[model samples]
Target chain A: MGPLVPQEIIGADWNLFIAFAIGIGFGFVLEQAGFSSSRKLAGMFYGYDTVVLKVFFTGAITAMLGLLFFSLFGWIDLNLIYVNPTFLGSAIVGGVIMGAGFIIGGFCPGTSVCAAAIGKIDAMIFIGGIFLGIFFFAEGYPLLKDFYMSGSMGPLKVSDVFGISGGVLALIVIITAIVMFKLGELAEKRWPREEY
Target chain B: MKTKYMNPYLAGVLLGLVLLMAFFFSGRGLGASGAVKSVVVAAVDVVAPEHTANSGYYSKYVGEGKSPMKAWLVFEMIGVLVGGFLSGAFSGRLKWKVEHFPGITANRRLIFAGMGGILFGFGSQLGRGCTSGSALTGMASLSVAGFVSMMVIFGTAFALAFFLRKNWI
Candidate 1:
């Protein structure tokens, strides 16, 4: 009943338009939360600020719960919604590389774009670097293709792996986020410094 | 000294709603890296059409019926730029400056930012997504890829935090 594109409720042209609108909201929220600042984003690791953790986990949990309820009420068909397939080796390795990038670059792809929008010269350079990195990956694809597609575990869900329902997993995530929020607050207090 | 940020929880709810709307209307969740990939492909095609056609990876995104800029992610990314600009303007955070720590020079910070971006770009290709695409949106769909990406991205950052302490703290 939902996922208008896959269900053919919306045309491809409209899908592109919708992507733009969604991106606006996504960027607005990110900027409002101070995600445009590398210092603020990096603060998540140093305990000077926990806005990243708070916003990130809260957003994740809210989306998880929303999907669960939407499915329960038949507002949207969960099956039609795309689930990212897991490629275990690449996922872990890529994530690790991204992690290093996060600490070093102090911005992710989305946030970096946001930062650049606000006139951060560094953000612009970072974006340039992304292009170069991607170009490098493409040129070297033959050498890395095997590992890139390795450890295919299909599109398994976290709930499926844990032998639980999606709803239950959502609950666990919400609870866990709350606990982490508390710890984040404590950490900030213990390591208070000038605001980033 | 400045406008306070929206409550994190409220911001989260709003973000989630935005994400939900994305799935409902587009049949897919949010993404960021894909936009960059589109740009990369387009650049390669423009500069070296023959090379792009010859390469397996570049060819996939080029050739007949393909305008790399026509992708949904590209439009979305354009919107992100607009939205960010608007938000910054309204919040009075719109300023032309290089953001960095007092301990570091702007040049140094920018260099690191570039290096970091290169790493993230390469990593996103390998990982199949960046934070927004793989970690956040993936987690929303309950995909293991989402959780693993989230864990490793954050875990590695935390592990390397000490080494990069001079950059931030």
Candidate 2:
């Protein structure tokens, strides 16, 4: 009954409007969580501030549980939702490159956009770099095509792999999040930093 | 009047609800990089139509009666910019400044920021998503790609943190 757009419950005309509305909430929450601060985001790795860890895992667990409950309640069809396809080779290698970018740039694409919106000068330049990088990737697409298309696992689920229910996995994730939050708290105290 | 951030858990819950709403209404999770990609595709299409028409990667997104700029992610990204600005205004955090480590020069920070963006943009394309699109949304759908991306991205960052200590700490 839900996933209204795909189910035809919500008209196609409203799709873009809904996307914008959802994005507003997404951006508002992110900024409120202090995601607009690159230094604060980078603080997670340094043990000075663990806000990123606390916020990120908590958000993921919340959505995972929400989806599970929605499915259980028949509010949404889990089958209808989009599942990201897995390409192991690219996933791992690409993540490594993104990780390097995260440490070096201090902001991911989403966070960088938000930071730029708030008038962070470095974020603006970072966005320019993103455009250039994408341009290069497109121009060189012929060469990287094979590696990019390799190892297509086709939307594999962790639950399917573990032979467990989504709920069970979500419960484990919740427990893991709690433990991580504890570590995060400890780290914040162990290495407090004056405001940057 | 600079206000403090909301509690992390509370903000996270709100973010989660937004994500849930996305799935409930659209059958897809939130994304950030895809919007950027759409822009890139649109730009390439305008600059060199024949090149985009011939290129395998760019061809998928461009064609007759279709405008990549009119995509859902693009609208969402515009909203992100507006929402971010509104929040920043409300919290008095809106300022034109370069934020960086006290130890690093602002110019050096900008240079790194640009380099980092380049790498992230390229990587997101290869990986099929960035933090929001791949890691968060994928995990929400219980996909292996989501978990793996989350782990590897964070792991690599942690591993490289030592070498980049001068930049952040």
Candidate 3:
């Protein structure tokens, strides 16, 4: 019942307001964590900073745990939340393409938005590229329509695939993140960056 | 100006709390590219109403009295811009400049940045979401798409990092 808008617990007008407030929190946290810098973002791959991995996994796990606890405590209904449907082909292929894009552009869409807001010219160009690329996709939809809709897996969860409960899976993730953070700390020490 | 950024772990915690709050209130996760898609569809519709109406793809978003600008992600992203600007201003990082590896020319960097953006934009459509939507938010909901997309995106980047060393390293 806690999905206030969907459950009619909150008015429709509050939807956009909540979105705005959440976005502010998201953007603030992203920028305050130094996500505006490309070098710092790419550091996850290079082991120079590794803040990306640490922050990323930590955020994911924190939310995962929070949601689980909320569900348990009757604060929110888990079934109301939207889960991304799994498309085997598009998920891998699209992600691969985006990954290549990440290294080349030095920013993901979200981080790019944050960077662009901070007056980053490269990020602005990246934003332009996003529109151009999307336009190309939209125009070429006829040719790629079949491929895009090829995979049709329902909203599957990793926990179910692993035959474990969300709490258990989250626990493992927390433990793994702890180990990764230690390694990340070592990596940052081993390969320090002059900037960011 | 405060140059000190929040500790990464703390920032992560804050970000997580935001995501959780989003789920609690919206029954959905955060997104970035979906808003761009709305803008793109609306732009096309405005520029060529006939074409947008004719196309199966663009027609879904346009021609239905549905203003793409009136989307959740769109409003949230406006807030993102404002919040980002505020953070940058407070930190004294709000200067207009191009950032790149020292080894690469500015032109090369910009060109690659565009190319990457192009690929990501298209790929996000193909994948049905961007890192924030499909990966981060998906993970929060424990969806398989989240894990798969997150792995593939980061894994591919790791695999290609050596080849693109001049760009980042």
Which candidate leads the pack in DockQ?
Answer: 1
Model 2: docking quality category: high
Query: How many clashes in candidate 1?
Result: 0
Write one digit per residue (lDDT tens) for candidate 2, span A1-196: 8899999999989999999999888888888889998899999899998888988888888899999998999999999999999999999999999898899899999888888889999988888878887887888889998999999999899999999999899989889889999998889889977664
Ranking by DockQ: 1, 2, 3
User: Model 1's CAPRI class?
Assistant: high
User: A71-184 in candidate 1: lDDT tens per residue?
Assistant: 888889999899999999999999999999999999999999999998888899999989988988999999999888778999899998989999888889888888999999
Instruction: List model 3 lDDT by residue over A1-196, tens digit each.
Output: 6888889899988999999999998898899999998888998888987888978998999899989999999989988899999989989999999999998899999999999999999999999999988999999999988998897889999899999999988888889889989999898889867666
Q: Candidate 3 local accuracy as lDDT?
A: 0.90
Per-prediction DockQ: 0.87, 0.83, 0.83
**Candidate 1 accuracy as lDDT:** 0.91
Of models 1 and 3, which has the larger lDDT?
A: 1
Which structure is stronger by DockQ: 1 or 3? Answer: 1
Once fitted onto the true fold, the runs of candidate 2 whose alpha carbons sit more than 4 angstroms away are B1-3
Ranking by TM-score: 2, 1, 3
